[model samples]
Target: MIKTWHLGDSRQSMVLASFDGRLPEVVYWGPALPDGESHQAIATASAADVSGGMVDRNAAVSLNPEASQTFPGHCGLSVRDKNGTPLAPAFRFQTETASEHCLTLVFADNALDLTLTFNLALEAKSSLFKLQSSLESADEIIVEWLAAPVLPVPAHADEMIEFSGRWCAEFLTRRVPFAPGARVRDNRTGRTDHAHFPGLIVCSQGTGNTSGEAYAFHYSWSGGHKMVAEELQDGRRHVQFGHASGSLPVGRTFRTAPLYATYSENGLNGAATRFQKHARNLVADGARSPRPVHYNCWEAVYFDHKLDELRSIASQAADLGAERFVLDDGWFGRRDDDTTSLGDWVIDLRKYPDGLTPLIEHVKSLGMEFGIWFEPEMINEDSDLYRSHPEWVLGPADQIRGRHQLVLDMSRQDVRSYLYEHIASVLKHHDVGYIKWDHNRVLPVVDASQTEGTYALIDRLRSDFPQVEIESCASGGGRIDFGILERTQRVWLSDSNDALERQRIQHDAALFLPACVTGSHVGPRKCHTSGRVLDIKLRSWTAAQRHMGFEMDPRELTEQEAATLRMVTGWWKANRDWMMQADILRLDSSDPAIIAEQQLAADGSRFVAFAAQMRPSDQVLPHPLRLTDLDPNAIYKITLINQDEAPALSRGAPLLKEHDLEVSGQYLMSHGLTLPWRFPETIWVLEGRRL
Candidate 1:
């Protein structure tokens, strides 16, 4: 028996399910119905011999030919029975419920009294589908492995791309040819570590940046996860992803994390655009009315806190057009450094004499919203909280700590309640507008059960304080996923704010996520992470491209630099609405040293492009940089912003002297203008408006 369902606005997506009297298998999933066809398209595709009848044992069986016979290539549900035997290829089709946008299919094994349900949902406006599964049983059963939405791809998808990275340097793309067998990317760290991101992109043999067919898969889970892309013996490829689970007794039910899959005929950028649209529509609180310009006090005064010094910094930030001022770490109890006082949520009287009231009031008076930082999920062994409740910490009794901190056993209700109350007390007592929530350490002991408790805490926080904004950070870029984004407003991209490094990080991170939800800040001239000094012009230009913010001390800036900061902030404030609402288009560049990105409004009225030179290329001469995603028929006036900072060229600087150049969008994209040669670490911004 088989069933086919049509999904999406244009009815272009088809999900084909076939049941061979045992379990239901998803045979084909992609694109929509062909012209003048209804269910025939799927019926014809699944008619092929999916069973292992024609597969020759001598050729099909690599090592053990009998292994492929009993356990077929595709199994909807993979489980072991009570007698330590794998379940046979048989299941009773129970029932199915369907709606315009969703379908729920159920199957059962009466002997084991176990039931499995697969839920599928299609986004109304795009070809993005979400898959999740749940298992329930009436009797006690030991479940070993469970995966949801095991989707099959065509055989032509021979190229694969996955991301891997370290702390300061993240999102390095790795492309390889998809050979036979399986390739798995696992994230066992309790939190999404900086090492490997949880996403995969598979393309056809000749796919390029903006052309060809591409498919992408990403998990919504922020905890330990595993993504497997396998090419079976029948020349079919499939992808399966879910939370990493261990054997456990299933008394009632277990649900797997949701996996999002999208396809694009227009290449990787087209697929990324679909994902960004889906995410923007599903944000918990919706997009912020107007994204705020933030000023963080971390790099300025790391562990040193003084009321007068903070007041001066806040005043300077407000003067530079910053809308929010955040007081970073070292403001909590006995927390002079990272070594102690992580769990203590109370204010440090020694640092602020009177509590946070003085600093908060002063910041509010300066016309900026006051924000504070907290690390509620971590605690130091020397802290008062850990000493009082030793059992609240995770791991062994004599466990090794990371960054001098132990993970709080969030799975324990008592631990969750204690941290919740303390964190809530701070929010309730103060007129705080934002919270920079930081998770500094990874879980040494992996516990899948703790994920639910972490979600509960965040859900409750959002429910209790609906007005407060939260920025999720796990040592930077660690806890970024749809699950966490549903509860938080923004995410910090990296701890290193060096402009040159950030260009690559933000460029790749924006592949799946939009720039509006990513937090990019300007650091000191001499970046603390890379120890590379960059000019303020380059740093400010790069930061202005995203949810703009400043992390350096305003007092350190000279008069000229301060004026530049003011100008950049003012420009962002004026154009942020369009910036946030535009679709990001990553232009194809032949030169590896140059990275180009564009933000074009949905209605094609305005566009902003940022071009940066990572290092000095061999070709010192200027070349034409063509733009993308513009209306070819419309005439646009291109103006080079912040060009006053450009050095005097031999021809008296064409970019600086030319206030504006009028050109047709067709000409600008095809026969583009040239950019002058500047020093390394130089960034240029071009703004185009349809006239």
Candidate 2:
């Protein structure tokens, strides 16, 4: 017999589970019919004929069978018994409940004393639905594999899109054909590493940026995870995601992370918009506050920490209208470089004889909030913390270190207490308003308990120091996910601050997360990681679109460059209110060299658009770039923001100010304006207001 549960508003997204008088199997999960048609759809799908066709008798009841007798494509629960054999026990259907926005179903394997519960919930005012599963066993069970909310996609979804990248380069999109068999992507680095982000996009053939059926899934987990997209023997497809569960005992109940999934008949961009709306609802209250413009000292001073030099930089940052000042590394313990003193939280007397109080007070006196950096989850073996407590590290007797540091065994109660108290002590002593939390290395072993312990430490900090904001940085863009965003305010998108590289990185990262939660900063003329030189205007233009900040030394800027920085900073402050709350729209262009994005307010009163010419291309004279997400009938006044600044190259600027002096919203988005493409690496910033 099959039972169906639906959780949505006027339109429903249905979940179907089948039981052959014993175990319940999730058979169908996708978009449902409109209000009145849902019951008929479910009844037709759960009919006796459809129920009998799911079983395969050729390999049924065999020891090494390829599939279960009633395998639901993707198994919700797969485990081993006490005798080291796979358990295929029958589960009896239990009770189910439904609320206004949530539906939950439960099943029990009475013989093994294991119970499974699935929660299906819909976002308050969105088409998105979130699914998670939990398992509870009365006796100790050595679970081998388990996945919650296994999703079934239509067989027509032949195109698969996943993201893969390295440290400085993150979120590079990859597309492949969905063939028969399992295609698995795993992140075992104990972090949502730079290699593979915890998200996937599957679409049917001929899907463009804005116009075809698509399904997007993102796992809201920061630690080790695995995402699988497999095509079954039948014409159906399944997408599964969960934490990497190792050989751990199921003490009482183990719950899996939520896999956020959304379906859109309108295409990839439509699916992305739904995910963004859902995230806005879940964002913390502190994060929703206006993100301040910051100045970080990492690219400025590196390991050369001098009191007098930093004071001068602080004054310059204040002059440029920076609201927050951050002192990066080399202020704590014997940490002149990255090799030592990672676990030490005390201020190094050699760097500042009067401690961080003097520097913190100096920055605050300049009308800027003071923030510091910390890597509390790592320790160098040569440091005092590791020498005193050698057993606190996570690896073997002879541990192999990454980035000259070992992972602190956060699973230990003693380790948690030590980190919590020391980090809290710093916050209590100084007038610190923000923290740049850095995690530099991957875990030596994958353990879910350790991840939970880290979460506990962050929770304690938030409870104790509610006024302090934290920025999560795992090297760069490593620990980015909704799991960490729940505790912190923002994330450092990438280490490489090259303007050209950041255009792509920030563009893709903004698909699932709002621009306010992503941290983008302007680096020096020459980026440290890529060693590529970019014009200060190009860098500032790209950075201004997100949570804006400066990562370079202010004193190094020339008088002309300084004036441009000040102007850009002032513009961001005046317009950030609308920018933070605006809906992001990514535009499609025929030439890949031209990348355009728009930020339009929800009320359609104001909008900001950015277009960049990444590099020179063969198609020099491209077509007029059209805008999106604007009120077609409303009249709008458009102006060039940096018309007074010098042109990016020797070639002249586009005739934007001459030809398109004034226009209506419909004419602007439909007819569009042609931007100048004379110079390589050029950027155009346009501001629009409904008149």
TM, every model = 0.93, 0.94
What is each predicted model's overall lDDT from 0 to 1?
0.77, 0.78
Give per-residue CA lDDT, model 1, range 1-691, as digits (tens): 5455555545246555543433445544556546565564555466555455554421221101112235444333455655567654234568889998898878776776777777888877655788888888775555555676677667788888888888877777878787777787767787767776778899987786667888888788878777777776667677777675452334457677788887777777888877776666655373466898989999999999988999999999889888899999999889988999989888888897778998999999988888889888899988999889988888787877799898998888999899889989999999998989899887877666777788899889889988898989889888888878878888888998999999998888877778688899989989999999998888898898889999998899999889888888899999998787677778766567888888888798989988898887677665677887678898998888856656665255565346788888889778786766666678878888999
By TM-score, how accurate is candidate 2? 0.94
Q: Which candidate number has the best lDDT? A: 2
Off by over 4 Å in 2: 10-12, 15-32, 46-74, 245-250, 644-655, 659-661
lDDT accuracy of residue 545 in candidate 1: 84
Residue pairs that clash (backbone atoms under 3 angstroms), model 1 = 12-32, 22-91
Candidate 1 matches the true fold with a TM-score of 0.93
Query: Over the stretch 1-691, how does candidate 2's per-residue lDDT look in tens digits?
Result: 5455555554336545443433333344455556565543563454333345555331111111113356534454567656667877555578878897787877777887878777878886657778787888886666655675777677778888898899999988888789888888877888888987899989977886657888888998888888778776655577788887572445667788887888776667777777766666555556636778989999999999999999999999989889999999889889988888988888899998989888888999998999999998999877889899989988796767799888898889999999998999999999989999999888888888877888999989999898998999999999988888888888899998998999999888767877777788989999899989999999998899888999998888999989888989899999898787777777776678888888888788888888888888667575687887677888887876765553455255566634344677788768787665546686888888888
